[model samples]
Structure formats: structure tokens, C-alpha cells
Target: MPALVVFDLDDTLLDHRGAERAALADVHRMHAAHLGHHGVGHVQDTYHAHNVPLWRDFGAGRITAADLKRLRSERVLHALEAHDLDPETFSRDYLARYAEHWRWADGALDAYRAVATRFPVGVLTNGFSEQQRAKFARLPEVEALAAFAVISDEVGVRKPDPRLFEHVLGLARGVLDRPALAPADVLYVGDSFHSDVEGGVGAGWRVAWLRGDDARAPEGAAVVEDWRALLDLLEIA
Candidate 1:
């Protein structure tokens, strides 16, 4: 049997990190209506300085999702002394506006589509369910291609954790009732060494690293620069 192919969402297939930055830039353009001209660079800088560290804390399991979403943007406004800004209102608004500005890398959808045709495909990523599912719906129609995954908040766990990896493969194997596959049959593809590679390796599945930086992992498997390169790595060409 051909292997089951799993993928990461953020930098792997959807260029989520890029999409987020672009969305922030777009949001800056729109926020001028309320925040005023001075508020532009002010809010932007404060947002980055405050939000990035909070997210890092979140990834390290140092914060709660409620705190992550509610406080991140709110703190930015607070730091900038924009006391009039309503945290809850603007956070939701920012989500919608961000999604609107979402963009995908070249050949991203086509690459996933091509892989989906020949093997069982699933998305194994770390993201908020509502947000990630929205992005998934937008491009590659990931939900249509892969019916199973372990999203961060949804799964009550994050990547680089072996149990979460085990959970994803187990679900993919139809383990909800009867097991249909084994760990060896799935190869998880992602951009993070700790999350994707370590998680998959620890869980006893194959791994493919979607390398963005010069970072290297000692584990033996495939590595590609981007989605299109997946074709070559999988020898689909």
C-alpha cells in the first residue's frame, strides 16, 4: 500500500505565517479609520512587541487560549494607551479582517491536490480550530481532502508532543472504534523540527521536513523547501 500522507498547515501548505503578517499590514490600512494616523505605527509596533512574546508563551503552554485571544491584542492597545479600544470587539474584527487578507504561496493548492489523489491525506497542525478551519476551507479545501486531524485547541494538545501525534495517527487509522492502519503507514510532513519531525518520529511514523531555514534534525527522512518540492521528495514527478 502507498503511505498515508499527513501535512502541517502554517508554513507547510498554507503559508499561514505569511498570511498573518500580510493580514496585519492590511488591518493597519483599515484601522486608520478609527485609530488615526499616529495610531498606525503605534499600534503595529506595540502589537508585535507584545503579541509575539505572548504567543511564544502560549506555544510553551504558558498561557490559556482564552488569555491568548483575549489579552494579546488588548495588551497592545493598553501598552499604546489606546484606552478607548474595546478588546473583544477589535479581536473578533481583526480575525475576520485577517482572514479576508489571507494569501497562499504559488502552487500550494495544486501540490496538495496532486498528493491527495494518490494516497490518504490528513492535516496535522497546531492552530485555533475556528481560524485554521476557516483557512482550510479557503484553500486546498483541506477538510474535503482529509477528514481527520488533531488541531491544537480542539485536541487539547500541541505538536512536538508524542501523544498528540499518536492521537492523530490513531484517529486516521479509524481507531475511534476499529483500527484501520498502523503508525508506519503514515508520513507526517511539516516545517517544524520539534513539532512535526520529533512528534512523528516519537510516534513511530515517517517524517518529511518542509525546511524554511538552515535548521537540521538528526532523524532520517525527506526534506523540502516548499509544497511543490513535495512532488520531487515523494517522487511524484
Candidate 2:
């Protein structure tokens, strides 16, 4: 049995994509006139295209969190030709709106409760500290369920970095009261194949790829569609 179970906070346990779309739509509506001929869909697509690669850079330690936040909005507005808008202000407002729309993934709380009862459950996520903390603040149950939460900003390193996984494992050992806990004694669960599955496996921990659709499971990894399937895979009933 695993000594601890670590989860990714965003799309894995929370409906972050849903919240992101809603928040982006709100921003688009707020700036529809300034957006010129570009529709909200176009704006969202533009932002996503830039945001994904920036986040990848973030995970690789090539960019700071502040850089990702500021540049994403700046690039999106530039693409929309909205030079009059302040990128920093737009990023802050977008984050506030995103926090307001926080929603848990279906069965997230139930799964957390179940798994926490049997194993020390914690979070290992790549995100800005304040923004991620605001998200957790909105869902007190998730915070209560987690024994610890290791965030990239706080640690000065992001996911897919072995150091981040090692740090989380150390924290998990303390929280689970198992000083002898090794990588094999923990299960890392997340939605991303590259960051979560590949990262955890590289760190020598078992991984569950949550919400993977029609994707071949990597060797020794579990691909699950939802929290219920994840719980079932963990034999938590």
C-alpha cells in the first residue's frame, strides 16, 4: 500500500478548464469592443496557444511565474491590437475572475475523502503561489483534505523537475509519519501525461494519469477518466 497519495490541483481535482473558459469569456465580454473584429473564441484561442507553451517553459525552469502571467495577457492583447490596455491589470483581473468561478471536478471531494482516509493525501501542483492559494481558499474542503500542498512558486521550481518531486516526497514522509518513505511508497496523480505521469515515473513514483482520453497508458502508469475510476484503481471502493 502506498504511504501517501499526491494529486495535481488543477484539471485533475478541480474543474479548472471550465473555470478558465468562463473567466476568459467574461474578460472577452468586458473588452469586446476593444477586441475589434476578433470574437471571444478567437481571443480565447490566441491566449491558449501562447499560454500552453509559456507554461511548458515554466516547468522547464526557463521562465518565472511572473513572466508567464504578464506575458500571456500582454501577448493576447497585442494579438488583439489592444495596445491601450495594461497587461498587468488585465492579468490580475482575469485571475480574480478565474478564482470566482472555482468548481471541483465531478466526484473530486468524494475521492479525496476516500483516499485520505486510507492514505495521507496531498497536492503537488505547478502554479503561482497566491493564485493557487486563492483557489484552495475557495474550496476549504480540498484544503482540509490535503495533508500538505507543494506549489511550484513556493519551492522555486515547477513540475517535471525531480527536485520538486523529491521535495514533495520529503513533505509527504513527514505528514504521513513515515520517515522511511521511499519513492515507491507514494502515488502521484495528475491530469498531464508529460508533467505528471512522466515526471512521477522519472522520479520513481507510481503515477495515475487522470482524464486521459483514448491515450495509451505509459508503462507502469494508470490512465483514468475520472476521480471514481482513480479511486477504483487505488482499490478504495
Candidate 3:
């Protein structure tokens, strides 16, 4: 059976952390009156320190998506000692700034093209369709390449969940016009260990854990340091 290659959006193919840092710098500039004492680096570090865990909590069902959105900026502001800043307003500003900067992970676009030339490609991401779609708008090439995209908000399920993986497989079958498509025929690639690696492996799919030179894959897991490594792993000519 031919394989269907599915990718995670943030941090996998998209340079989300880079965009976040750039956006935070913009926000830091705007709120320099309140954040003047702290460098933009400090603000960026503080943002991720709180932001990553909050999203993890959301994914783990410890917090509602609403709670994640409402509290993320609040926590950052509290940590920055900007008591005067309104969390809601700051969040809006941050999002507005974030929207301006979206780009592919290093070598990601080329890797995507390479893989797509030989195999069908799709996206299975954990995010709102609106936001994720907006990202596609910024990168038309990505949008053009994707045969289908399954957003968790649209599907009512998130990664590391068997149901969501099952949902994505069903979608892939329909899109590829291969009714007999099996889980083993899919390759799920993403950056997060708990979500992408665990979810893909759990779903009985071939998984490529994107470590990006950060760390080695655990024992037997397939690890790719970057898109170039991924190309080699897939044996894409």
C-alpha cells in the first residue's frame, strides 16, 4: 500500500517559535513603558515558559481551550510585573503581531516538496481552523500542497488521542481514494514527543519524531534532526 504523509503544523513544518519570538518582540516594543526594564529576550523567554505548559495542560484536558487563551497572557504579564497591563488586551495585541510573521521551519518547504513529489501529503494539527488556515494563507505553497487538513478544534479531538488518529486515517482514506488504506500505510511526523511521537506510534503508524538536533530519538523510535534527515529517512530521491 502507498503511504500518506501527514505533518503537524506548529514547530514541525512551520517555524512557530520563530514567529512567536518575533511577535513578542513587537509586543515588547509596544509595551515598552511597562516592559522597559526587561529586555525583549526576557519577555520572549517568559512567554514560552508559561505558554508551552499551558498548551500542554489544554492538550491533557486539565484546562479548557478557553482557559488556555484567557490565562496565557495573564500569566506572562504577572510574571513580567506588568500589573497594569490588561491580559485580554495584551493577548489581542500579541495575536495581531503574531499574524504578521509566519514562515516555514528551516528546510521544511523543500522537504515538503520533496516528499510530496513521491507521496500524498496532508496536515493533522491541533489548533483552530481559523488560525491554522490563516497560517496557510501566509504560505500559499503549503496550502497548495496539502491534500487535506484536520484541525483538532474542527474535529473535537486532539493528538495523543486514539480517536483523533483514527479520524485522521479515515479522512486520509477518503482523500487518497484508497478505501483499503491501513494505519501502517501512514507516516505521521511532528516535533512533540508526547503528542506526535506517542500519538503516531499508538495509532500503529510509521512515526518520524522531529528532534531537530536537539536530542536523540528514544531507543527504537525513528528520529529526524531536520527535513533533510526526514528526506533520507523516507528515501525520497
Best by TM-score: 3
Mark the regions of model 2 whose C-alpha exceeds 4 Å error after superposition.
213-216
Candidate 2 C-alpha lDDT tens digits along 40-150: 778778878888999998777788767888889888889889898788877877887888889988888888889988887888888888878887888887778888887
Q: How far does residue 80 in candidate 3 sit from its true spot (Å)?
A: 0.9
Predicted model with the maximum lDDT: 3
Task: Put the candidates in TM-score order, highest first.
Answer: 3, 2, 1
lDDT of 3 at 74: 88
RMSD of 1: 3.4
True lDDT of residue 43, candidate 3:
96
TM-score of each: 0.80, 0.92, 0.94
- The global Cα lDDT (0 to 1) of model 2 is 0.83
- Which digits, one per residue and each the tens of the lDDT, describe model 3 over residues 107-179? 8999999888988999888887799889888888776888897888888888889899999898888888999
**Lowest lDDT block of 10, candidate 2:** 211-220
**Clashes within 3 Å, all models in order:** 0, 0, 0
Worst 10-residue lDDT window for candidate 1 reads 212-221
